[model samples]
Target: MPMKLYGVSDGPPTLGVRMTLKALNIPYEYVNVNFNKGEHLTEAYAKLNPQREIPVLDDNGFYLQESNAIIQYLCDKYAPNSSLYPNDATARAIVNQRLFFNMGFYYSSIGAYALAPIFFDYQRTPMGLKKVENALKVFQIYLERLNSKYAAGDKLTVADFVLITSTMCLEAIGLDISGYPLVLEWYEMFKKEQPELWEIAKAGMIELAEYNKNPPDLSEMNHPFHPTRSVK
Candidate 1:
């Protein structure tokens, strides 16, 4: 059976999973879920991902959700030679920690500061862009520490994929990558070395910007990451 990725076109997590698969040269079937039409809210997609999420990966009969977990599972199973997942226990633990942090701090901040404001009903008084600026300042600090090439250094890992997709959201929200030197370095490296993977994210960036610019009527958007989600 071909590996199938059920995801919305250009969605963040979906983009991350697709990039990982491409980097590993893994052949998979792309199942595009129409976010504009509430396709992901359907019962079938919910069954594939109890979270009612995108980037649900089905390898043979085994299924996996959550972008990072899907990336790890595929790297360990199909791309053992790929540096996307570290082998050492301690180093692997570090990657897990940062990955968790990305989900918590990185993604949440961007959603609140960037996506929520423009897409969602996240209205504020004189603090619209401020929300994103503050969160990006925190990311700048993290990037200062994490600015090194690759996730764990020299070799690209799943950590890079996670950050790349998340940062794409930041840029979509007008967060300037150049403001943070280290993050910009990593960004340039990906642009140069993994041009193909970068292109995937680049496509995502453009669509999201346009969508957010003229957001559709998402009356059925119930997912946590929907553009009109509550940001507190």
Candidate 2:
């Protein structure tokens, strides 16, 4: 049986997994969960993913959550010989480090500061912006340290697939990434190199930007994850 992936149509994490699947030539079915309609909150989805997050992968009834983990699993299990996930211990370690950095730093900060304000109507705080900037600075340092065509090293790995999705989101929000020349260069290179996969991410950004044009409704307003909601 073919693998099944559940995710939002325009979700960044979903895009990352989709791109990874395409790059590895792994065939899978995609189920788009409409978060705007609260489809993810339904009992059926909760059973598939108790955490109620997008981009859940099911391989013959073996379910998995978390975008990074899914990407690594696809590469490791389906395409072990693919350089997109190097078998070399040192190279793979770098890829793993970069993936963790994206989850803990780059992606998290951007979602909190940049996306929360636009999508959830959360007020942007100075501290939040500072955190985003600091994350970018660290990304710049990582680029300098790796000094390769991709995030982890010369070849494109799952790290590039994941980080690029976050950076694409950053760009969609009109955050100027010019200060980080390496990132900008990397983005441009991938834009040309991986046109089809890049289009998958770009299409999602376009949808998100369109959705942000109008004011959100009561359902969106009342969501606990809404920007204005105070964390307990």
Candidate 3:
């Protein structure tokens, strides 16, 4: 059986993994979960991932959760020699740092500030918005320090895929990312170089924006969007 990727198409984490799979030319069956319909909360899905998150990778019955780990596993197993994830320890560490930053700081802020209100009807607060801006500023700092075309370094890596998706979602939600020149430059470069994958991400962003316009009814939702801690 081919590798199975479980997640929605436009989701940032799922999209990041999809972009990695495409870049490595790995063939996988995409199993899209309809969270709005509560498919992800079912017992069947729980067996695959107890946390009930999307973008779970099933490689021949070996299940893996978390997009960061999935992408790393793909590059390590399939494309060891590929610069998408270098074999050098120091270089790989830098990439790993960026991946963690994207997950913990960048994407988290965006979800709290913008996505929460849209998905779970959480009231947006001043601190939530500040977190988003601070996250962008920190990203800009990373871009400057790297002094390269990509987030990790001069070459594109798995980290770039993750960061790019977060950046796209950030921009999609009406944030003016133009203030960060380095970020804008890097994001524009992806549009120019990776048009197909860029469109894949853009389609998801468009869908998310539509949700913002017409908020969904989560009254009957079995598994609502509630993160561990409220944005502070």
Candidate 4:
């Protein structure tokens, strides 16, 4: 009857969409898929999202996937006036560019290195550290450009959400983001700018990180933690 959202409890992509809904004051039902249990691979969930990813949104009969798209849809349909998406060309272009960079550049390096190493327990071997280093270098460069003027005009948009999500993973993976003063400033600003939503997001991230740190039961999920994991 009402909007239904399929998501995982611990994934950042879904968390970003959920937070956007909260920030925009949109109400929806959240359905949690246990990724570790491969619930997403079941035929029932596949009917909702063929890709078997979390953060799928079903509104009446309309279906949507991808975290950014879900957030944009909520903003466009429920709160067109929200600062999440800019109306102007330049500002919109900036947001798009940053989003592009986020996906194209940072996604691979960061996901494989920082996120996999820590969250997946792939082990931060030399190769893993190198991948993380490359990603962090890109993050540093990216943050340097995010002065008071971020991806869009002077407001917080989806771009900031995407960056911050990945940054949370980066921080947990043993990267010292403090070297980037502007990034630290921006992180503080994102938290201060939306204290309530940020607090909720921070709590979610902390829970995810803590869960990842624990020794997972190999039988809990078919996917066992990669051997050679380093204890931090």
Candidate 4 per-residue C-alpha lDDT over 4-87 given as tens digits, one digit per residue, 9 for 90 to 100: 889876566777777777777777888888876667767898898888778799998899988777877887788787677776
Can you write out model 3's per-residue Cα lDDT over 1-232, one digit (the tens) per residue?
8899998866899999999999999999988898666677889999999998887999999999999999999999999999999989999999999999999999999877877677664777888978988998899999998799889998988898899889887766777888888988999998898897787788888887877677665544565446222222
When 2 and 4 are scored with lDDT, the better candidate is 2
- Clashing pairs counted in every model: 2, 0, 0, 0
TM-score: model 1 vs. ground truth: 0.85
lDDT per prediction?
0.74, 0.82, 0.85, 0.69
Error of 2 at 195 (Å): 0.8
Q: Pick the candidate with the highest lDDT.
A: 3
Model 3 scores worst on lDDT over the 10 consecutive residues at: 223-232
* Residue 65 in model 2: lDDT: 94
Q: What would the per-residue lDDT of candidate 2 be over residues 126-165, giving only the tens digit for each residue?
A: 9988988888889988888878988899988888888888
lDDT of 1 at 11: 76
Where in model 2 is the C-alpha error above 4 Å?
215-232
Worst 10 residues of 2 by lDDT: 223-232
- Alpha-carbon deviation at 230 in model 4, angstroms: 14
Could you give candidate 1's per-residue lDDT for residues 101-174 as a string of tens digits? Answer: 67787766665665555546765435645655555567566656755567555677777777788788767756
Clashing residue pairs for model 2: none
